[model samples]
Target: MQQYNPDFDYKSAAEEVLAIEIAGLKQLSQHFDTHFVQACQTILNTTGKVVVMGMGKSGHIGKKIAATLASTGTSSFFVHPGEAAHGDLGMIDSNDVVLAISNSGESGEILGLFPVLKRQQVTIISMTGNPSSNMGKLADLHLCIKVPKEACPIELAPTASTTATLVMGDALAMALMRARGFSAEDFALSHPGGALGRKLLLKISDIMHSGTQLPKVTADAPLTEALLEMSEKGLGMTAIVDADNAVIGIFTDGDLRRLLSKRVDIHDTTIGEVMGPNPQVAHSNMLAVDGLNQMQERSISALLIVDDGQLVGALNMHDMLRAGVM
Candidate 1:
């Protein structure tokens, strides 16, 4: 290993590497032609999953490409070429599409399986730096990722070429995503444990405080009583409802502060007299992320959930934070 040079301009060296990678991506973007469309169409028309195969550093990029395809509505998974030869080739079918990746376009492990894949009549899409390499020539379609040069000083490590390959994979995934009309909800279902899942799949009913957990006071109740309810519930606000439990207004800490500034009598004031009428509210079925948007739009910290004009639940920014809905 080379020793670190304290006086060397590491920032400039890093910027040069970035420049090479950027150039590679720009080159990749320009090469997106009919072959790219054909590859997308081939994958889209496949009834079975996309079976991505590669070796070495290409295998790492292939795995990521497979994952991206799967999460964005295209069913896909990575299979190491060496592993496929051992037995995983059985996982491929006539209806499946194979996405083989190699910078040199000569991965023997992958090329060795070409005959078997052809026998199965599976569609092959090769992504490589050479359009005429054995893998490309044998494939049904070839997508080139040839870059101007590698970012490595010795041109030994897979740097700019790998970056180009990854970007090409991304381009394919996104194009297929648009072609399939994949929505955020669709993406959320595939990523139930991720942040996008929480935002899109989580509903107000899933995280709201319902029943006795909801802070409420009748329209005729005193401001002091509402304050006590707000404190006990710890939501910093209380819904002011009518005799039939329908939401009439809301009173929050901000309301109380304004009342204090006006020197109003908390003990004598009716909740209805001081409450904010027609408060911003959402239905229990609304997406928690939508509720978040409502609060943000109105510049409020809390929201009351209602259904059919009846107060059903309440939630605040703190609840959104705890539920991972923010």
Candidate 2:
């Protein structure tokens, strides 16, 4: 078994790699000019989707770029260059834009599709390291992602070049997002199953315990009755309401513990006398993420749901957790 070296300069080696990649990224930024703007404008004005194609390492980067573009309000998809020659070219429409990635700008697989893309009248945007190469010369707009050197010691594997490509893709996606005025709600619509979606889309009404599930009692009710309501509902608290069912106050497990420590008589005391007045309340339509922020800010565990000053429902931290909004 290979033993771990306690004196190994792993941190130094990692820093060296990061330094090389950072320099490569700085170099890539200098190459962004009129062609980059033209590429963005082409995609922004495109009526159809953006088709991304590459081979090998470029293919992997192309897939991620496609995903980023699609998720950020751009309709995009990745089609393997090899597969495009095998009938997948039908996926491309004349109105769409093609983004072909090749580190050397001479990938035969990607180059082979240029004729068909041209024949279909689709705009070709090429991302390559060399602007003088065949694919770059053929492209309607060429965005160069040239890097000074590979981060790999042997200079064989793609490291700095891939990072620069990924960053350039992100820049394009963000530029498109800003131009489209893409909001968080629009992003949530596309990512309805992700945590960010839950945070933005989930409302208190969707998760709050309503109707008979609410732990509530009249303000004049005995403290023992309030405790019974809390225990029966299993919410660790009970809302103290007036005659019109408007929340007047709230009694919780913390209040019970404090009362017990002070030797207060729970059997004889009225809930109105011991309940906390003016409890924090939430609207039914309020976002669950906002509720979580309220709870954290106020250092509380539960909130009473109200509408037009009448108690309607209730929820706690556990509900937020179960809904994946935490």
**What would the TM-scores of all predictions be?**
0.93, 0.94
Candidate lDDT values, in order: 0.93, 0.93
Q: Write the per-residue lDDT of candidate 2 for residues 149-182, one digit (tens) a residue.
A: 9999999999999999999999999999999999
The ten-residue window of minimal lDDT in model 2 covers 25-34
Number of the predicted model whose TM-score against the real structure is largest: 2
The list of candidate 1 runs beyond 4 A from truth reads: 1-6, 243-245
Candidate 2 ranges beyond 4 A from true positions: 1-8, 194-196
TM-score of 2: 0.94
